[model samples]
Target: MESHDRLCRRLALLAGTAVLAVDYRLAPEHPAPAAVDDVMRALEWVASRPKELGQLLPGTGLAGDSAGGLIAYLAACGLAGTPALPDVLFLAYPNADLSLSLQSVSEKGEGWGLSVQDLAFYIAQWVPDASLLGKFSPVEVARAQPLPVRTLLATAGHDPLRDEGKLLAEELARGGTDVEYRPHPDLVHGFLTLDAVSPAARHAGDSLLAAYGSLLSHTAMLRRDRNAPPDAPNGAT
Candidate 1:
């Protein structure tokens, strides 16, 4: 919720890309089932209004960072085969594992912006039962659905959640999802929003822009082909 308004401003600057950021209820105040439920409702509401996005929707993709990334994944997964199925997913240093066992968690605790303890505290405040943890984490999805969506996964080499992001990307690919992984060797977590002091953070922002362009172009090409006249011959059949 802190960054959704910022994302909306950023999206306005982009030509063909449109982003609809959800403002889910925060933790402790509005924990677990309520939080996830709020996210689902937001997704449904946004999806119900395709015209609000102009052309950057339906086949358009999803993107998020940190906790927002977690929500984006769950939203995208929930939308699979539905009216809102995203054509691609862009994740930056996502909080894929609430378990917080990634090596970077311990190694880059102070520098990563988001620490294991912070994540634990958030979860403690939000999640109702320990058993529900597995359900909330996208890492436990085990098998990915062939939504035929491409993914852009970026992780900071020095971040505490690096391996989890990497693992998530690998699992997506293993499940037949197209994934593009970027690991910034010199950066830490929360670089996208705090790039003023981190050069790598600016680079990541640029990379995300590029990834959005790629996916948009790909979607456009597919649209063109699908809408082409029947008599207009395609080289393939």
Candidate 2:
């Protein structure tokens, strides 16, 4: 988490947003659902004691990249129907299926810096229990339900998890979720962290931030209207 501080600051500034990053526990020591539990606990603490971390959580949305993306969507699913349900979900190249059996696994799995073998090794360390993979899998959990009001799923051209992300995006949209799918044709996995050296990655990153920020403001307005008194104007400012 400490390693992401600089990127966190960058995201906040570029997106015109305030961030409350969770320093969740890691795998091999703290495995599957531990990160999910940690995030929920963090949210609960802040929600119960808003004054302790005022103005940070506007309840607008959730965003995550890579493995964290999977956890974020799962957490968002858990928050469904609650007031904490994010208005928008932003997932950048999420590791959708833990099984690593997606079609792209063989297509782009080789020479992409992130291979199926590597994924398998990490998944074992994180999950440990083969029987629990389906329980912790977003791809499995998502098939039975719709996502939040809005969902943004981005996929990399050469990422092994690309097809699963694309499939989930389509499924969410078909289920009446307002989905936005962005595919970076030239970029690969972990492009978010490579924006410093790649202009295309930087552009994509900025575009994502702009879209998410805009959605947050729009949703905030709608929420305010919904909570307003009946006497107020239809489009009250």
Q: Write the residue-wise lDDT of candidate 2 on 90-180 in tens digits.
A: 8899988888887899999989868888888989988999988887778888778777568888999989989988877877877788989
* Candidate 2 Cα outliers beyond 4 Å, as residue runs: 56-58, 232-237
lDDT of 1 by residue, 1-237 (tens): 565565445544552565566667787878765655665676666667747556443356667788777877877777777766666777888888877777777888675567677778887786757778877776776354443578888888878888888888888888888888888878878777764565767667766766676776787688778977788466865
Residue pairs with colliding backbones in model 2 are: none
Give me the runs in candidate 1 sitting further than 4 Å from their true place.
1-8, 11-15, 33-35, 49-58, 142-147, 232-237
Minimum summed lDDT over a 10-residue window in model 2 is located at 52-61
Best by lDDT: 2
Clashing residue pair totals per candidate (backbone < 3 A)? 1, 0
RMSD of each: 3.6, 3.0
Candidate with top TM-score is 2
Candidate 2 has an lDDT of 0.82
> Number of clashes in model 2?
0
On a 0 to 100 scale, what is the lDDT of residue 31 in model 2? 92
